[model samples]
Target: MTRSPVLELRGLSRRYGQTTVLNDIDVTIPEGSFTALLGASGCGKSTTLRIMAGLDRPSEGEVLLSGKDVSQKTTHQRNIAMVFQSYALYPHLTVFQNMALPLTMRHLSSLGRMPFVGAVAPGSSKARNLIAEKVGAAAEVLGLTDLLHRKPSSLSGGQKQRVALGRAMVRDPVLFLLDEPLSNLDARLRVKMRAELVALHRRTGRPFVYVTHDQSEAMAMADQIVVMIGGKVAQAGAPRDLYDRPASRDVATFIGHNAINLFQPADGMPGLHPAADEAVIGLRPEHLSPAATGALEANLETAEYLGSEIILALRSERGTEIRAIAPGDYAIPAPGSPVRLGFEPTRLHLFDEQTGKRLEVAS
Candidate 1:
């Protein structure tokens, strides 16, 4: 049996006076799952996160948590936590203090909150001790225990990132929102953090709503991905599902490493359709292999040698350029050499050239 979504966006929309930033977006985030909203900049991905976090109000829609309307709720009232790209830690505070700020603000009031005076006053000390225990547990989970006494400035980028994550984790919110939290880290560190985050999510068993423009990040970390384009959701599905069975040519090209090729059906072609004058063809680089003899031929333009694989860029007689990835150590064809290319018909994707929508082809 299917369970209700932990978080839901119903007809969510946002507009900035004359321009619409997000348009009637709807999505369901399952409990204890990771959902990524991915797209290029200004596609309203960030706006969607803000709406769910109650940091920004939707122009016309409702935000729901466990089927309860939360559009009218404020950020603090929604039990949502966000880790920002900048790692927004307090400069003057130690790691311990930084993580404890949320708890402190929740229990303590202004002016009467000196650490020494607050320590012994009524239930303040007991509350602080409880918060410290929770913070320490979160830090340990994030591998930040050793840096608890250190200031944010002393930590490395990765460590700072962990601290930011710890800060959010301490809240134990129903939903966790991360906005490009790893974007500021180096490539190697970003990759490492992705694995850590996946492990953390599994350990915590809380729903995660991650917003990122990096397709690779979204592909690697999310159980479900929502692709946004021009303020609307283009598609939503698992990474492989989106890659293999794209609903449209736009989605096919966006999520893959190589751009999909488009071809016009030739006259007298056996399988050509009268309505299919033009068709979009999607072939991944790995799908292209050197052919000894085939119905298709192209002139090798250039070859790029990666440590593990070689990529070939070739242009066909029809001016359609394609890419092929092969073992790098193998001999590569000379530039300008005419080469035969072959592909299984079943591997090819066909989409309506006019509408850019996928077409069902018989096996």
Candidate 2:
């Protein structure tokens, strides 16, 4: 069954004076799915997220939430929860207080929010109890029950991030917007939090729009990845779809862990296909390796052992540098030794040299 879209950006574009930040952006975020908005810094991903949260407005286009146009709605009026990269927790408030702040602001009257008066004000006690229940539930889910009394100043980076997520979770929002929420954590902690976030997404059953610059993070966490380039959406689809068949040369280079080796016509063709004479060819390092009787030969320059694999850097006879992966157990050859490299022809990616667009080459 095709789930309905929870949010849609129709022809969305953001501008600052004479400068354009986002250009003709159109994206659909399906309900109960994780979608990642991925791009390098200053590519307008954050601006797109801000516009979706109603923190910023688009100069051109509409922001739709579940079929309703919310282009002009304020952040509070949109009923969307946003977790920033900074964690955004108040240092003066305990974890419980931080998590409960959103509910209190939404459910309590001005008189009911007064510290001492809130306890005795008419109808305030009931709202306070409800808030407590919700906050307690959120804290339990995030494993912060024991740290509920601690302020943001005393918590570790990961704990603070969870508190931010807890605050968002308690809102019961229609959608969740996270702007690089795990960027501040150490590498090890970031990996741990990624699993926690996936579990949280399942528990909440709400659409998540995550913004990130890290391709690995996007590939690991999102069902759909929108790769933005030059302020426009270059591609949007499943991570494997983008990885296996990129829409353009830029996407092929950006989506993979190891940079793709791009061979131009000027850089002597490997003679893999007739189409190669006029098009650029791309091959990933992992797909190319040293073979005893390989078609191409290069002089090994450097070999890096990374536990499970060895990265072999070599220069082909045509003066083109290439990187290939070898088994960790593979014997290392001396520098300047000739190495034969082989690759599966089916793995070759052809692109138009002029437009940098992908070219379809029949097997």
RMSD values, in order shown: 2.5, 1.3
**After best superposition, candidate 2 residue 141: deviation in angstroms?**
0.8
What are the TM-scores, per candidate, against the unseen true structure?
0.92, 0.97
Off by over 4 Å in 1: 109-117, 264-276
lDDT of 2 at 134: 97
Compared to the true structure, candidate 2 yields what TM-score?
0.97
Residue-level lDDT for 145 in candidate 1: 88
Which candidate comes out best when scored by TM-score? 2
Error of 1 at 268 (Å): 12
Local distance difference test values of all predictions, in order:
0.83, 0.93
